[model samples]
Target: MAQPKYRTHVGMVDILPGEVEKWQAVERIIHEEAKKFNFEEIRTPILEQTELIARGIGQLTDIVSKEMFAFERGDDQYVLRPECTAPVVRAFVGHHLEQRGGTQNLYYIGPMFRAEKPQKGRQRQFHQFGAEILGSDDPIADVECMAFMISVYDRVGISNMSLKINSVGDPESREAYKQALIDYFTPHKDELSEVSQNRLEKNPLRILDSKEEEDQPFIEDAPVIGDFLNEESSQHYAKVKQYLNELGISYEEDPHLVRGLDYYTRTAFELISPDLGAQDALAGGGRYDLLVEEVGGQPTPAVGFAAGIERLLLACKEMDIELSEPKSVDLYIVTIGDKARSWAIQQLPEFRKKGFSATMDYAGRSIKSQMKDADRENARYTIIVGENELNEGKFTFRDMEASEENQLPLDEIYGRLKKKL
Candidate 1:
């Protein structure tokens, strides 16, 4: 038989044991910071009807058009959600949550999917920690959401980020601005990429978000959306900025900062870390006044943001933020003879039941080798259960750090370690 070929997986990743501690630390900070703002956790399925994303997230945008992992089941096509907001809106409306609501503050942390080329801080399967406030149009709500994102970064010790803000206006104002973009980009259509050209005809506003360097000057000189904002939208945006100013939150207005989603209107902002090379955004979101209604709900105005966990972690590394290393084993039980090995194994369940993390060497190594292994585990203490010690109903407790060893009765071991932990 020809030699069997083994191929490694592509476009997918498995987070291994070493990376898990970083993920846990990130989740801990996210949960702690979100709770401080009274944001309740909300979870939506990974699979959503394809149209839900197509309609709400914009079929023209990269997420819905190119990146969505869509598959068909029976008659309906479903997508592994590339973003959180659309599915959340579907859950909010389908459950009729607004009927009971003054306003709902919701947060979510989980995996999201996109079929894109994986790069540093950009993966096909990645995680996001996001918070959303539904059924409120108050600009303070916008500021609060921005502040919450900033607080998470600060808590994680990520620093020196720039906040970029923009206003795309409400329906009426945007309709006028769209025409201006179409007129400007229409003349320069041949000079633009095929994707930009298509966007120019369909949703011209998306042209502002194009990263093509050749497209920059034309995009920059294009009419500002703020100038075309209607009175209500202009005031809404102004009030959001006023709240940011009063709270001493600094931000720069970027006319091109329209977030890449169909739902966003009025305020849009992104917290970016420049140290992250090309994919610099750590977190970004904006006001979505039409999102609830877009997903077949009654007219509801909502605003929220999603922060990329991987990007945030990258920012932490770039900033040299010292994340705590994973908590060490409370105690490691080292055994010599076969009898002591069996005894140590039985004692593990008891130690863990009492809320202490305990482990024993299963390899049946020599007593000296086991002690070395305990040291490698960064164990607070090691219990040596040699034949002699086991016969005496006692074990030698060696403090891994202090190089101190003392004998203690097996009955008193759990109690003694509990205090040390």
Candidate 2:
């Protein structure tokens, strides 16, 4: 094989053939399960206003500050969306989806762009699918969102995943907590990593989720968010756990489990898969009750979760869960001689119009080679178009799987194929 003149950019992948089957398999499960939970699929443009992402995800957040693929042209600024939940909410508020609705349950599946260097399961251009239940503040709504998050993994045969849950508390509680974190870490600021140092004053809660080795010592002793939760936030957080327990969804409480994003509040959860090795997180999501109101809508409450499609499929592969087999063609047309080739090309569409997946030799290869092609493609049946069969007004149809051949007219072949199918 010759190398192509072009290649995919860094931090990207070509999900060709065998691997794409797994993606399709996973995607189908996602659609079916999402619909089962009353999630309406919504597609937003991959390009969004830069301000929307900065404002929605928070300016101090890593995604907005470091990982965003954004640009400014003239007076206008545009960005490739780094996450879906924010864009979904933007569309909801922009399109007035609330007017005709009650608790709009929307879901999205598409690619997101970030400027970060790619790793095993992380990509600069990665795909994510998530569900957002807007207009509900009930902790049971939080429980349902979390359940929906793990439903795909449950059905897809992935195993050995740990559910880690935490509460960042609401705004009022979070403010006092931020001050506590600032005061606690301020003295040790010089000893912390640059990232952690920057986060100390702007948003101290982010330091808790830092991955820096040096920062870990300081983060280890920092105050937990649960300690600062007010009466209302504490009640809401307790209800979320109660519901999870009732559903038999076992979870471990983590003090520093604040998700990477700044929008999350009250409830946060991560599904960890040991199969992923170093980058072991399967998915992370939490409550963002202030998101809708932040985006110029009324003070509507919402909860959502986002999972990396690449990461999920990676986990499936690591666990040796066979998602799908190689796709096989229904019919392969093996043509010999000029006249027979013409006849095959003419009738191929008719076969397809009637819903048969048919393919033919455009190379005009030898009959021997054409037959080999049919075998290679794993075709279920091979129809030989040749002088003898063409003159007899019948075709040599061979059942590739059975290694049996028979002389059959077109209608008979169609009938037999339909019956077998």
Candidate 3:
């Protein structure tokens, strides 16, 4: 026997029938919550210029340096975007969305590609639903962004998640903290991992974001960004906490919580859930006032967060949250006898045109097997067509849940379904 030569990629997933229902439920809630926050949806292409990612996400960051799936085609280099914020900003700038006038609250739902060691929930091709607020530097904008994120999970019914927040300060204090980090880690340089050793002079904050076990010791004892927050940033950070408090949103201040991206400034946060084993972060985002300028736009303030839909489904499963399924079959038609089959097939489109989700067996299955299909599909009603019904000038319609059957003319069958179902 020749084995199948093709298979799904290692870190990719197929959202199949039974499982896709959960995705539908989660996405429904995401859309509903985003609507309440007044965030309109924006979609950017999955493929973006490789240089856009490298320049916007930062060359020193792990996403651009190691994980990007880049290729050169003709005169241009392209990458399957590892994240959406940069591209959203690029569209905002390139298309001049600012002409629309107010601070735009944009949300997106799509797949983001990144090559990483595949794990449960965190896949190479993962779906994310995130919202970004452009043109507002107000600390309230940051609080609202976090609140919007928290509200999405709340509506999703995924409990036991904690919000952890911090401030990276602005550029000046960030620079001060980098120097302080260099001073502190220079002595223990030999104990650091080669990656940390390489990142020390270029961007030491990324070293703090490292996952290498060997780098943890120095990372733990390193100077915290809180200690380096300049007065203006200190006020900004205080305002974010105060707003969160005013709105009754609880959070824990985490000094070491610098986001993984380089453009982040001022506020940073993560939503952590114990449902994910080692990598507990369910979502993370922060303020990136410099990202618009970094992506070729006029300097604009933005705040957003991205959460993995796969991880969210896992978390829902762990919490025992019930996910509602999508619409089931409204009508299943079972035809017997060649003449009745021919007649039923002709009527199928008519039933559908009357706003019923109707389907039938074209494979000439037995009545018993056709009825089984109706039951498996959770059909609300099943209509039986046969020589007896054709001769009687009526059809046999069954209320599947109540086990009641009635003989009615074609128009009356539609009336009964419309009235009762």
Candidate 4:
């Protein structure tokens, strides 16, 4: 017989038991925080029309230009969603979620696909939990979204993160800033990285997000969007900062922090953890007032943020914060004979029905081996029943943790275990 191939694809990972517990811990916090903020859950498909991302994320952006897993399907082109915001917007438009006319607070937790080189805290298939607030352009909405993001990090025990924020302004202001960037970077075009050189002509704002070492020196001096913010955008940014200060959240204003998305306007922010090395951004979002309109819906104002679950766990690990372990079964039953095995099967379901996690050895192993397996499962108690014990109508009840043993009637065992558990 041939051995079956058993390997995960490149840039993807299988989350085994131990690590999955940590992921659950983070997800619980995400759900809990979302509820507290009045954000309902919305799940969108993992695949979306290729044009949705192209139009939403912008054609010149690296995610659309290079990293999306796009392919032709029949008469249409589809791509595994590289991000969720665009798909969520597509859903909002398709479902007419905004026709009723009030703000919709929605959140989602799922895997996003991006065809990028795998690295620590990054992969082709990565998970993100994000929230979107649609309908209101108020600065308080931006503050609320940011506060919720910070609260999630706090609840997850990731405290040493820095929040860097900036305002890219409205479209008119952004265009003026873009021209300034082109004018400034054009003089040093010969020295800029190849990617930045292309970005300069295509979408100069992307040059600010470039990680190219050669581009850094020139990028730092290129242009500051804050300098060109119009009256409305400037006041909106100021109010967001004011509210964040009132909420006592410390943040740094970064002139070059334009998020790597075309839809963002007015406010942009990123939470960075020093522990994540080169991939330091733990989460990021901003106001995208034009996204809905861009995706064929009414012009709606919205704000959102997405944090990488892998990055959050990495931050927790660096801080030496341990997540609570999943609870194990209350008891493991060891049956030493056929009669005892039948008796064990009868009692197992009763224990489970009574809300106690219960299990019995089905492999018919030796008592010692069964006990070892029980220990590995971290069972709080172990019940050993043998032919003699079953005949005597009593069983050996052992407390795994305390290493104490007691002989109890078979009928009385369930009640006693229930109380102890």
Measured by TM-score, the strongest candidate is 4
Q: Write the per-residue lDDT of candidate 3 for residues 305-325, one digit (tens) a residue.
A: 888888888898888887886
TM-score of each: 0.96, 0.96, 0.95, 0.97
Consecutive 10-residue window with the lowest summed lDDT within model 3? 319-328
Native-referenced Cα lDDT, model 3: 0.89
* lDDT of each residue in 1-421, candidate 2, tens digit only: 9977998999878888888888899899999999899989999999999999998999988889889888788999999999998899999999999997689998889999999988989989999989899988999888888899899999999878989999989888888888999989999989999988888888788888787899988888998888889889889989999999999999999999988777788999988998998688888898998888888998888898989899998888788888998788899999889998889889889989989899988887898999898888889999998899898999999999889999999999999989987
**The best candidate in terms of lDDT:** 4
lDDT of 1: 0.86
Task: Score each candidate by Cα lDDT.
Answer: 0.86, 0.89, 0.89, 0.90
Residue lDDT tens for model 4, 113-145: 999999999899999989899999999999999
Give candidate 4 misplaced runs (Cα > 4 Å). Answer: 1-4, 99-101
The number of clashing residue pairs in model 4 is 0
What's the candidate order when arranged by decreasing lDDT?
4, 3, 2, 1
The positional error of residue 186 in candidate 4, measured at the CA in angstroms, is: 1.1
Candidates 1 and 2 compared by lDDT, better number: 2
- For candidate 1, the C-alpha RMSD (Å) to the true structure equals 1.7
- What does candidate 1's lDDT look like per residue over 1-421, in tens digits? 8999975445567777767788888888888988899888999999989999998988788787689888997998999889899888899989988777688889999999999888899788888988888988899889999999999988888767999998989988888988988887888889987778888877787787777878878887988888898889889888998999999999998878888787899999999989898678889999999988888998888899999988887888888786769568998998888988888889899989999889989887887888788877889988888789877887898888899988889767777777777
